[model samples]
Target: MSARPRPLLLGAGTAIAVAVTLSGCTQKASSEDGAVSVTASDSVCEVSKTELPAGHVSLALENKGSKITEVYVLFPDGRIAAERENIGPGTKATLVTELKAGDYEIACKPGMKGDGIRQKIALTGKDTAAERSPESDAAVAAYRSYVLAQAEQTLPRAQAFADAVKAGDIEKAKGLYASSRIGWERTEPVAESFGDIDPKVDVREDGLEDGQDPTTDWTGWHRLEKALWQDKKIGDRERELADQLMTDLNAWVKKVGTAEITPTSMANGAKSLLDEVARNKVTGEEERYSHTDLIDFKANLEGARRSYDLLKPIAQKNDPALAKELGQRFASLTGQLDAYRTDDGADEDSYTYTSYDMVSEAERKELSDGVNALAEPLSKLAAAVAK
Candidate 1:
């Protein structure tokens, strides 16, 4: 089974086009209000403008492609500044983020695969420092600290899981698998911003790109997952991949400090986490072998909550009704998810849930509906906070 669209933070230089266009009378990319228009189709990705003043920028994405598409605003180094994924054919969505004066690229993936078509863009003007408030700055700082803490905690757990896999202890590795991913699930958008790390540490078998050799190119948690669950045997390749996974994770921990995080990014990331749940976890595609989708779903919810809580003050002050609606929606979704808990334990850190495969279609629909209800209000968060 092919995996659903997975989030990517970086791409290889060979796969991306980095040419910048300084002068063109091509389609108008930016509106008078400063939102850049992006038109994505099977063969082309057109932006309204190639250069603009730096600060808060919005990309209004229209997916003219036949397949679902995703768009990314990337730093010159390939780090993701902001992205909007899972825009269905003929549908439209918006992505908002903060950018400083520098060179960047706007990339569109028609089928949400490969490195995508790239258009180099330049952001010229003053820094965004003058436009920000102390509260918004604090929210960004707090979210950064939270992301760093999750990364710090993730390493030891992931190390333990890796050690079990390398030792060929199938039962121990299975035991540690879902718990090990909690930190990563909670802050996935941040990990993905690094571009090179997420695919190495988390990509599934079906998520492999064209020309990617499974025997050699496929290396990550899912590779080891198939070994333990489907093959029911450990081999040299699995052990080697286990070690590689740890190396990639350690690099991710080190890179978190340099991620481009902002108030709008935090709000946007919170919504994206919900999209992850709706698109993959709810469909039981993420953990096909282990049936651990619920664990990931819970972690994604927690991560979104963390971002929302950090920005709640600013959002509340800006739009009280939207803030209240978001609060209720989050709580409602939390309640729905809590019913799946397998343990009566009060410790959230030690909680578990029924395997995703065991969940009925009706239950999944209810969960999906809850996510949609929350997502509608959550989508307004970036604009609310940016005010």
Candidate 2:
């Protein structure tokens, strides 16, 4: 048996990799009016003014906390409107959000995990941001619609996979695993928002503190993957893990429907998806037991492309040059991936890919170069759309 590679996530306690905050693009608060000042420290979340006239609001957040922290503007029911994650101590970042007249909350996550400390905020006057930028609003709606649709498709398939495992049908369960993961991978950030559930549903084996100690530390999708493929049996433990995964995924599907999708989030999500490809999928680290890393690679690329498509109109309207470059780069990357595709000759998304281990070194190098090329233009997308 081949030695399993470490997974992208580590440990049950590890936080989901959130969006890389757009700190570099922030402007000085002194020059920007209607900017709300927020100061975060070890113990509390402080907002300069809790009451404000509604419209577009900029949050100038400074982290004085010792640990890396995050701040979020949440809807009353905990959907994220805007957030800045991974703000190191003594650093500052800005998040601009279009808020309407509604009840809201500001949550400061001091250590970047758990339910955050919250404070109520009041918004007066009508929401002018929606009226001001109809394009942006439409983009958000389109992305949300896409996510909800993916969720609907994912739920039944995921449940079937779980059911197969529970019934001790190892081969059937194995076949269903890759396809069932598409929706979850595509809408990862929204799933990550439900911190408690993400780990249960998607945490990989490397995420365990004791990878060798299956009894004590192992659970979730990769746990079942290892059992079916490596141990070659389905038993009591497999059944339990499958049941838990389905439960978490079911709750995730319902919960993410309420998630707020914004242009900034769309941009950040695209970058994060490619980041997944570069950091883990390209390295053949994601599906070590199954040797299906290429499947994840394709899924991450599709996820990134979907986000780019959602924001393309706004991005083009904002910066035509950058937008054109991005489109071309995406095409280049797609063509490169097209080379490795199996003769099944189905659509790009449904095309079956060869195992990563089967590809020659030179082919892998070309694929890696293509990913790097896409990353260059991909990184600029968030700031371009935000501007």
Candidate 3:
């Protein structure tokens, strides 16, 4: 609802998506190292925008810093073609550059900062086939790791922010949430180098954050936080909804340490939570946009459940506590999600100016039972096997 591009929430998510799409296949094949060598200042890459031809090339970057340095081809379209790492100050490191026919940039990161230092590399003709080459297997693996670390760091921080929200420290919660999001972003370019890693199935690989898409949809976990937690224009309408959302989220988090599991039990329970998230998807903005984007978020969460289910036997055999923890976390998140789908979510009080209505005792008990049932196999699995 703010004036900016929802930058705090979704910028990181959109960037990560492109990284996965482009991973591995971003560079051109290289047999030898030969590129137009340009000497850059400590600040800039010393190349104009239209300098490098749109084809295979390489850079032997010389870091003029006091410590380790890196130089990257920061493409205009968010494509990271090539980079050289650990280039010692005054020593040269070779980086192969494979560019397509478009405008591109080059920048040396942090230690050697001037301006973000821009360059425009233009391809005279089509180089899509040459440029979209498959990445080496190792490259893909490294990138996948980069993404997972990003997520692991982000999830906990977001939870902390949510906790602050639950405690009524709105300002503190907002600040923490912002800081947490910063962790998710900033390192995105690092993950961009990976080729061949698809996040949906690769738990090891970092999945793109959904909150950052330009189009109107809740992509990231905290994408709507800004809207819901703002000081201005947050009348009963916003505050009421915020409370509804958080109440569900809190209950979900509480369940994390206590959920029960087995494939059948987990599936039935998880599916219920999944339906809650799906049916309650926030119709925050009514703008017509890519339906696939909506479908993707829904599918990604669903896939996450499948992934958990596939690994259930392992949990059943070993690591039941993790299973309970994971199950509770998933359930909590889905329940919180249920609070957002204003139009279709069962919690109508958020969307309408209704009084405090509670879920039916029968329904509540069923959900509780479904979530906690997984503990049987999970506890056994943890006691008997390796996590």
**Clash number by candidate, in order:** 5, 2, 28
Model 1 per-residue lDDT tens digits across residues 1-387: 125334344534434333454232135546666689988888788889887788888888888889888888887667788888889999988787888987787878888887778788788899986678888888888999999999999889999999999898999999999888999999999988887787788888888887879899988888888888889988889889889999999999999999888899999999889999998899998898999898899999999999999899999899999999988998999989989999885876557899888899999999999999999889888888877
RMSD per model, one decimal:
2.9, 7.5, 18.9
Cα displacement (angstroms), candidate 3, residue 22, comes to 29
Computed on alpha carbons, the lDDT of every model, listed in order, comes to 0.84, 0.71, 0.37
Top-lDDT structure, candidate number: 1
Index of the highest-TM-score prediction: 1
**Ranking of predictions according to lDDT:** 1, 2, 3
Q: How accurate is candidate 1 locally (lDDT)?
A: 0.84
Cα lDDT of model 2 by residue, 65-141, tens digit: 89877777766545556666667899987666566787666777776555566666778897565563677788888
What lDDT is reached at residue 45 by model 3?
50
TM-score (C-alpha) between model 2 and the true structure:
0.72
Against the true structure, what is each candidate's TM-score? 0.93, 0.72, 0.32
lDDT of 3 by residue, 1-387 (tens): 111110111122232222121211222322234444534444445432234455545454555556544555644434345544335667764444345565444555434222234444445666543332132223223334433554455456556655665556656754554444332232222222321111211111012333533333323333334443433223433344444444433433332332222222222223332322222222212101211112222332443454354545555445566676667765764463344233554532112211112334464344344434432233232122211
Count: clashes, candidate 1: 5
TM-score of 1: 0.93
